[model samples]
Target: MKRLIAWISDLRLAIGLLILIAIASGLGTLVPQQESAELYHRVYDAQPWLGLLNGNAILRLQLDHVYSSSWFLGLLAWLGLSLILCSWRRQWPALQAALRWIDYSSPRQLSKLNLAETLSCSDASQELQRLEDLLSQRGWQVQPHPDRLAARRGASGRVGPLLVHAGLVVLMVGAAWGALAGQRLERFLAPGNELELVNRRGETQLTVALEGFGIERDPAGRPEQFRSQLRLQPGDPNAAVPLPASTETISVNHPLRFQGMTVYQADWALAAIQVQLGQSPILELPLQSFPQLGDQVWGIVLPTRPDGSNPVLLALSSEQGPVTAYSAEAEILGTLVPGGGPAEIAGIPLRIAGVVPASGLLLKRDPGVPLVYAGFAIALAGGALSLIATRQLWAIAEPKQHKLHVAGLCNRNLAAFSRELPALLTELQQG
Candidate 1:
């Protein structure tokens, strides 16, 4: 058990685990995740990298969902365990040692230090007292004994490592908790539509209304960003509403955080086309993607006759204007704008009412988000505090020899500590 504990708490083992976790995270970034099996097979199997890595290997390794993979989560868990053990076995004892004072008795003991010196003194006791007062003035914790004195500065550096370990462990636990119980849902909604938010009991607890959506475009007619206008209301509108409904707009990178859930505008799509034929009522025709023509090109088919004999395709690259009409032979007949002049299609006047756009909203709920934030704050604070150099000083006075022996060392920045030691001896001599 002792050996196992030692092995788990080994510093090298912890470092190795960190390196492995970093490499795995890098790989996860390089690989696309949560894609369909068909997409993976069609892409990876068509052109296998290195002639060995195919879709089969990717699926076998569970790289499609790297973060949720058993091996990846296991690595995080192992690293968290290592941090806990290291703090318990190594960092705690180191902190305790830093808090204690070590008295130097003889010249031999002072000579063993990296920085040691001897100074002539008339009254050793008076010099020791003055030195202790000087150290206290310099913000060092000074403890004077009958024959010796010790001073410590920046001892808080010792606690930094323990705080860092605790923060990391909390972070890992929070991540694991989020992964186990969090929820992510993506839904496309058009204006006047609503998405139902369900609870664990399969009851509708809330309703997210798609009030409106708009796409902001540059002067060149290219989309710069898209926003979704939404409202949150009670699932049953007739019930006495506890939460007030308010309209909000959310765009890419600017999400709406409300009631423990976050809503983001993720994507946009052309849902349908509204048209009117002569004296008939306005009709909405569903649009389909045309990847062969170009990206973001959507088209709809409408039959000229009542029996749906000959179909004419109306394709549009964007929602603004200029919808191109294509005949049965896939030849462009004419181009027209929505809500503009009527177009003659097979001798029947046709007018385009408008194009309907749908907004893709992504909602996420993570209970451990606050815990993760706290962990990050603690980790960053600890990392900054650890940079403080911990310095220790020891001195012993010999009235018979009329010499004061001083020694000091620093956990970091030893050269600066060495220079300070000489300056300290000079001050004692002057005193």
Candidate 2:
């Protein structure tokens, strides 16, 4: 049992676990996570990732969702175990030892320390008292004994490593908790469309509407950013308190945070086309993706003749118009811009009214996010606290020999502390 504990608390084991977690996290970043199986097949089936991982292999190994994978969670658990063991076995004991004062009784005992000094004094007892009083004034916690005195400063530094381990454990636990119970939903909705949100029990909790969407473009007509305006309202019919409706805008990195959920604007797509044929009512045709033509191309078929013969394929890539019409022979019949004049395709007047676009929003809710944030704050504070130098001072008064012995130790910055030791002795004698 002792050997097993020693191995678990080993520094090298902890470092190895950290490295593994980092590598796994990097792999997760490289792979697109939580995508549809069709996407995985399309992307990884033909050209396997890393020349080894095919879609089948990825799905089987749960690589498609690495952060939430069992193996990844196990790695986090193992790391947390190492941190807990190291803290319990080593850091806690060291902190306890630092907090406890130890007395040194003689000059020979004082000389055993790294930095020590002995000075002749007219009144050794008075000097010892003065030294204790001065150390207390200098923010040292002094403990006086019959023949010796021990004091410590920056004892809080000993707690830093323990806090670091605790913080890391909390971080891993929070991440694991989020992976196990967090919720995520991705939706592509046209403007003025609403998406329903549900809780863990699958009851409706809220409704979010895509009130507006716009794309900022460069002078060269390339989209720079996609922005979506959203309106949120409570949807539960059995709720006691009425939740007020709220409106907000979200973009790629700027997400809307509300009631423990975050809504991100992820992607944009051409949804539909509005067109008028002769004196017919304006027909809004839903667009279908034409991946063979281009990544962003969408198409809809329109009858050009009264007999429903010689149908025209209307395709558009963007909302900033110029839709192309293709005949059955795969020849371009005409190009009509939105709000432009009617185009004669097979002798039928067709005019493009407008384009409808959809915004892809990804919503997520994680209860562990607050815990993760707290762990981050704790780790940061621990890192800063670890830099403080823990210094210990010991003194002994020998009235018979008319001598005062002083010894000091600092956990870090020994060279500077060594230089300061002699000055500290001088102050002790002068006092």
Candidate 3:
């Protein structure tokens, strides 16, 4: 058991696991993952070799669905295990050493350490106390030993690896949670239409009503902006509360958020006509609602009598007379003739005027977003401190014959340290 633990705790194992994770995660971003049957078929049709990629064995192994595949999750699990084991074994000793008080006694031993400072001070204790005070003032906890002073500072270095590990765990957990549980829904609404967004599970819901939508354009007529006026309501249909009007409007690049859900302007599309039928005409009618192409609506208009015995209506010019139509439907419409045909337009009992194009909006809700944000914040802060803020110490003391010994150490930026150390030592000696 001890040998097994030791082998697993090796840095090589941890590094290998990390490399494997990076490779797998990179592949996740590179490949088009399993989405739907049609998308899979489309991909295979586009790249015929894609079918061979998932040989029957590989398909069952779930390589196509890499992100959520058991092997991928298992790789992540192994990564987590490797981090915990390696940190526990390697960092445990350094953490103990950093936490323990340093013993700074034995003048002879200190002199041999290449940093010994022999001071000409009549009051050694006072100078030592001052040094201790200075170090403490600079955020280092200090302790005095029998022959000399002992201090162990920056013990927090011990926590750096642990912090990074914790952040990785939190980040991974948050991302996995989001992948499994985050909800996204898209809706298209005209100027006055209302929409209710449903979650992936279809359990939770939210409603948004569009008050208006418009496009802004530059002086040259190219579109410069698009905007939407919306109302957000929370809770069930009956007990919902509407948000303030000022909060309802969202423009390009601006999004609306309410109850932890965000709504963004996605796209827009033109609206179409709706049609209905009534009980009594024997005549055949042409398509009343024409499909619009660009901004224009075009269609063929043919006319027939209600009894179907009349010839089709065609526009023809008479000799210097107004354009005449040679069908009974047009002639019938001239007089107050009654016909048994559709009572209303489309299936609705009313005629539809031109429609205002609808604007599509995307709504997204994620509960683990806060955790991911916190993890990123922690990683950034830790990384910045590790890269920028560093510890340094310069010591100078004069011994016999006006000779002074100076020693210095810096925790980071060694090149800067080397340049500054000589200047500091020279200044100390001259002073």
Q: List TM-score per model, in order.
A: 0.91, 0.92, 0.63
lDDT of 1 by residue, 88-144 (tens): 888999999988878777779888999988878788877888899899988999888
Number of the top lDDT candidate = 2
TM-score of 3: 0.63
Best candidate, TM-score-wise? Answer: 2
lDDT of 2 at 90: 95
| Candidate 1 accuracy as lDDT | 0.86
> Across residues 1-431, which tens digit of lDDT does each residue of candidate 2 receive?
99998898899999998999899999899989999999888889999999998999999989899999999999888888889998999999999998888777768888989998888988888888888898889898998997679998998988899888888888888898888989999988999899888766898889999999998889988889999989999766687877789889999899988888888889888888999988889988899899888888999987766788889899888888789999998999999999888988778888998999999899988888988988888887888889899999998989999988899999999998898778877776665
Stretches of candidate 3 exceeding 4 Å from the true structure: 1-35, 48-72, 111-130, 133-140, 151-158, 198-204, 215-225, 237-247, 271-356, 388-411, 414-431
Evaluate all candidate structures by whole-model CA lDDT and list the values in order.
0.86, 0.88, 0.54
Cα lDDT for residue 2, model 2?
90
Candidate 3, residue 340: lDDT: 19
Q: After superposition, which runs of candidate 1 have C-alpha atoms over 4 Å from their true positions?
A: 1-4, 35-60, 234-242, 345-348
Model 2 TM-score relative to the real fold = 0.92
- List all candidate RMSDs to the true structure: 2.6, 2.4, 10.3
Clash pairs, candidate 1, are none
